[model samples]
Target: MPDVEDLFVEFETAAATTFRPPGVADVQRRIRGRRRRRGLLAGLLAVALAGPASALAVAHRADRPEPRPTPSVSPSPTGRLAVRTVTLPGVSGELAELRFVSARAGWALFDTCAGADESAAGCRRTVARTVDGGVTWQRSALPAVPDGRVHLLPVDAGTLAVMTRVGYLVTMDGGNSFASHPFDAPQAAVRRVFATPSGLYLGCPPDGVPTTCDRQRVLRVSGGLHFHQPPVTLRSDAENALVEGADGRLWLTVGDDDGLTVVTSADQGATWQEMPSVPRAARQLVLAPDGRDVWLVRTEQPNGVWRLAGTGWQPGPALPDDTDGIAAPGAGLLVVTSAYGGLGFVTGGGYVEVSELRGPLRTSDPGTSVSVLPDGTVVAQHGRTWFLGVGRGVDRSWLQLS
Candidate 1:
């Protein structure tokens, strides 16, 4: 009988070669088929170990099997960004989180579950790296299995970090290996992780429960993964939205007893200057691909959207009622994700809908998301397919990626 490690190596190779997202029905069939093969392998291994050489020899005859599984900045010719699909080698399943440190290098976190059944026990947490844009990918092993959604923070081309309810995972040599770090000091669940030139910051709540994190407490780490509370003070009792500028400056919105206010910190989080308060509370902050513009999105009823101008915010036209999240493809335009399904591009004082792209980013499909690359290209994920949004206005189209 072959070694246990060798058996798994063979199984993985066969699994990768057999799984591909050709269509909805095809993916389901492949998943079911792979599960059966895995079950057979497990049963055979059990029987072989249960007895002696005789059982091993008999189990060898049953061999068979298979299976497996960013935004940019520039405005295109038509006033919006154009997208061209770049097939990723060795990648399948919907992207749970996609982040890029540069135009050429990035990382993605996804699972092996078929369709929208992410709660399935078979959904294995998988991570992949892409160096040549999103053209190809290299799979990496995780330090520990994630409990829920893992936040992807790319420090550079090779260094990156991921955080979940458990703690932090850091990889200096890309994703080759990851080292675990505990979330002890803060003693709260890390909902958001941000990377800046100064270091890494984690947004943690007072307690582990509650859907929204109040208190405006941020833990900053410089050289090591040790998270300590910074000297900076925030006034918000609600949730705060944070974003880093091109010049390493930090901008965030705070909602306190006085209402909602915008603030910026140039010297890390030591100090901040509060701007004029806005009418609505913004839940998310997005910086443009070029990093020259910032937009605040309020997911509440009216779907309020605002662009930073001087010290105040300039309100854009109201987004659709079903708006879930927003991303900036360029300096002035926006890509809005709908709760029903699909995306919308805000341009020419109005918006154009991309009906072909299904799976509403953060709402109906919680796994789906949209991001702009540093080069101004908009990338979005639908069910099991990834897409790059290219062209502008009517020319805008989605190119499917692996």
Candidate 2:
């Protein structure tokens, strides 16, 4: 028999000869192309120290589909809020955003490279609706456009504010049909759309052409398609998240070529107040229902901590573990899903300490998003689908978490 040490050396020699390093220039080109494509789609849109192949494996795990596992539970005497993981049905591509009008009725915006085909606009892009508490989902056909990204804001049970990569559309009759609003721009990218009590706030970046600087402004719409006010120039950058507080103030988080910027408007979006630098790479900004607190969830790690900077810009507290995403249940309550494992919550001023509600559901590359139902049930979106977990009951059902 061959010696074990000799066999191991032979195996290592064979593996080294078989493997070849990827060219750095080739990878750089791919990264640049992806960035340009993402910018054209919407200005709004991660990391591991592993090798390229291993990193891809990790990313695939983060974005993989798996059977919903039973969520871990942490009992608290205050029982202030309960957090759990919910899984929903997802299509191929990736889920961009999720919103719920009630516990059962909700809408999700999905984007995919498959839509690059000209046959069907939704071939790659879809707006999925769930009527039965995310148990199932039905895809709705959106108007065709060049890019294949959709942004949806549910006005009420029957109305929807829909924006595509090409332009804006609205449906008053539950998305069966849509009325297209023509806006001139090479790329009709919309970063964030907010349905405020006052009206609808549309955050769009500047046009693709560098000569025309006038197109970079936030547009306000009221009573369906009626243009209520002229566009407001908040930033030359693209806004990622548009959130409204119970106080009726509008908060906007904009991302430019440089970095992330925060601005607030107390009186609708007519006027704006620029806040201190958020100083991080952020994908989205969410405001608590009370409107007194603000949370910034960074897109990268190490500094991926959630910052609570409002009334005054100060670091609130980091999450219990490193997370790639975050969601607000209400004021002083936040749901954080780790990029590694687990879902937990942080509460109170000074934002001290975190308690895990569910630890690592064995999900691959968890593309997580959480929304609180009117009943306070926390629904989470992992990749292309959603799942629901009982807040205080410890009964976690894998109903679509969209």
Candidate 3:
């Protein structure tokens, strides 16, 4: 495991910074739900250095048969960024989460229950990972991370935790050694878990329960594995995302059958308030270049893009119907719509196409995943596979990563 200072220095020394956009964009794109634990998240940084030419060798502890990965690695000429694909041998589709600790080290968790609740019949589960910058992969059996949706968060360079149906699955040495930490709350089922820049959090009462009627509260989970509710109430209606910006400000979107509610918490999740100027139907929010301003989308019927202004959410521009892939990194927003394949950014109150999506995507599959690495690498799911766009602006060439 890399030490704290080592993680910082390694990540900071990178010529290309890691990009972490809003969580809503992640959810909209159906990729990993959380990103950016700051210092704790250093491993996910895509180091500018090219990876080892030889494939890394990883073997499971036991004689258990492990899945094989065919990693394609290549170097670039001079100033270009090298891109490669890591094929997860046993991953048969239901890709739940991908937590790339670095350009080389990454962890992935998969559960094919397909949105089943905690009480439903279990599904196939596997925890696959790469230690040498995705150069090679070794997979082993995973404990029931039965949430259908799981979140992998790095506690440090070598340690990462997964929130699942049973409890928290923790690994101390990359993704090898494992420990189970239960939610030490009464009745303790977690609907959602969030890894903020400061700490970890859980949405109480779990999912499959009546999210609208049941009590939904945000509980702070400590490093000691204890769960304590925040001084605030959080709705766990499957759409809420606690969006934290570079300045540490947080915007929470809690929605249900009734309507939507947006709250802001300045000091992490200790307390909250009904933040005005945000939509009641907003499923996600992101900070703008100014840091004070925020942008949101309804994502429901009559979907629209809005910006916060003067104590209220004002309509900014018309969102292309069925927009999903969302990545907002201050400079602007990178978004994709279902109808026109308009993969663009919000500019001067309207969406401007930045790159033409290079895939045959169906009209209904408004891709629910988007990722921006610190080095300005943009990742979006075109269909079952992922496409990477390099560099800082609209001049992006796409590369497919499986």
Which candidate's TM-score is highest?
A: 1
Model 2 stretches with alpha carbons more than 4 Å out: 1-99, 107-154, 161-170, 175-195, 200-215, 223-241, 256-259, 269-271, 278-284, 297-299, 304-310, 348-360, 371-377, 389-402
What's the ranking of the predictions by lDDT, best on top? 1, 3, 2
Q: Per TM-score, what order, best first?
A: 1, 3, 2
Please, what are the lDDT tens digits per residue for candidate 3 over residues 76-171? 212223355655675764655555533445665555664466445556767777766556778754555553335555433465556443446767
Each model's TM-score? Answer: 0.58, 0.55, 0.56
Comparing 2 and 3 on TM-score, the stronger one: 3
- Looking at candidate 2, the ten consecutive residues that score lowest on lDDT are 52-61
Count of backbone collisions in candidate 2? 21
**How well does candidate 1 match the true structure in TM-score terms?**
0.58
User: lDDT per model, in order?
Assistant: 0.47, 0.43, 0.43
Task: Give the clash total for candidate 3.
Answer: 19
- Better lDDT candidate (1, 2): 1
